[model samples]
Target: MDSSDLAYDVFSRQCSSRSTLEHVTGRWGALTLGALHDGTFRFNELRRRVDGVSEKMLSQTLHALERDGLVLRDAQPTNPPRVDYQLTALGREIAERLLALIHFVEGRQGEVLKAQERYDAARGGL
Candidate 1:
C-alpha cells in the first residue's frame, strides 16, 4: 500500500501504531527519549540521567527505540568501543510532546496527591 493510504488507528488491537505507541509511552521509553532530548548520551550517562532504570531495561528500551526509528545509536570503533544515543527527528518530535506531558504532571503533582488522599480516605484507606 502507498504511505498515504496506510491507516493507523491506535485504538485498534491490530493497528501497528499501537505497538509504536506503547514503546513511545512505556516507562523506560519515555524516560529514555526525554533524556536524549538535550543531546547525545552514552549508556552510562543515560542510566545516570534516568535515575532508576536497570541496565537491562535501559538496553532493551534503547534497542526498541532504535528499531522504531526514533533513536540513533552510533558506535565508534575504538579500543573499548564507544556508543552514543541520540534522538532522531521523529524522536525529538515525540520527546518534546512527552516532556510537555511530564511537566504538566509534575506541576500538578501536589494537587494530584491531594485528590488521591481524598479518594483513599473516602474508600476507607489511611
Candidate 2:
C-alpha cells in the first residue's frame, strides 16, 4: 500500500503533520495556543499573556499557527487597525489536548525535579 492508502503518520519524516505537531507543541507555539484558549486577544495582549516570548518569535508563531488552520487572525479596519487572534475550531480541539498535557506536566513538576536532582547527582562524579 502507498502513502495515500495509509493514515497520516507523524513518525514519517516526510509527513506534513510532524511540522504541525511542532507548531502546536513548541515552547512559544504551545504557550501562544494555550493563552488564546482562554480568549481572543490583540497582538500585544497575547504577547503579554504568553510572557517571555519576544515580539519577533510570537509573530512568527502566530503566522505559522494561522497557516496551519489552527488560528484565526481578525484584522479590523480602524484608526489603528486592530488585529485580534483566536483559535479556530480545530485550534480549540488541539489546544484542549495541549492544555491537558501542560497541566499534567505542571502537576508533576515536583516529581520531575526530584528525578532531575537525582540524575544530576548521579553524574556529578563523572
Candidate 3:
C-alpha cells in the first residue's frame, strides 16, 4: 500500500516518506537544514556555513528539500540576481527536532568517542 493508504510508512520501500527521511537526515541535508535554521541566507553564504559541501551537492540537496516543501527559495531579480534559501514552517518544525538530536549528539560526543575507542581497542585497533 502507498503512504496515503497508510500512515506514511517510512519502513515501506516504496513509501515517499522514506526518501524524505533520507533527504532530511543525509549529511548534506541535515547540515543544510541546520544552517538555514539560523536564518535566511544567500546561496554562497549557505555554502560557506555548511562547510565541506560542494556546490553541486548543495544545489541538489536544496532542490530535494524544496521539492519536499521543507525549504523556501526566494529569487530576486537584481544586478547580481540574489537567491536566498530558508526553512518553511514545516521545515522549521522538523529542524527543531533535528537540532535537538544534534545537540544531544554534541553533548555526548565525549562518551561516544570513549565508546568508539573501547570498540577499536577490542578489535585490536582499526
Best by lDDT: 1
Candidate 3's C-alpha runs over 4 A off are 1-6
What 10-residue stretch in candidate 2 is worst by lDDT?
A: 1-10
Residues 62-116, candidate 3, lDDT per residue (tens digit)?
A: 9999999999999999988999999999999999999999999999999999999
What TM-score does model 3 achieve against the real structure?
0.94
What TM-score does candidate 2 reach?
A: 0.93
lDDT of 3 at 62: 100
Residue pairs of candidate 1 with colliding backbone atoms: none
Candidate 1 runs further than 4 Å off: none
Top candidate by TM-score: 1
On TM-score, the stronger of 1 and 3 is: 1
Whose TM-score is higher: candidate 1's or candidate 2's? Answer: 1
Provide the lDDT at 36 for model 3.
Answer: 91
lDDT tens per residue, model 2, 35-121: 999999999999999889999999999999999999999999998899999999999999999999999999999999999889988
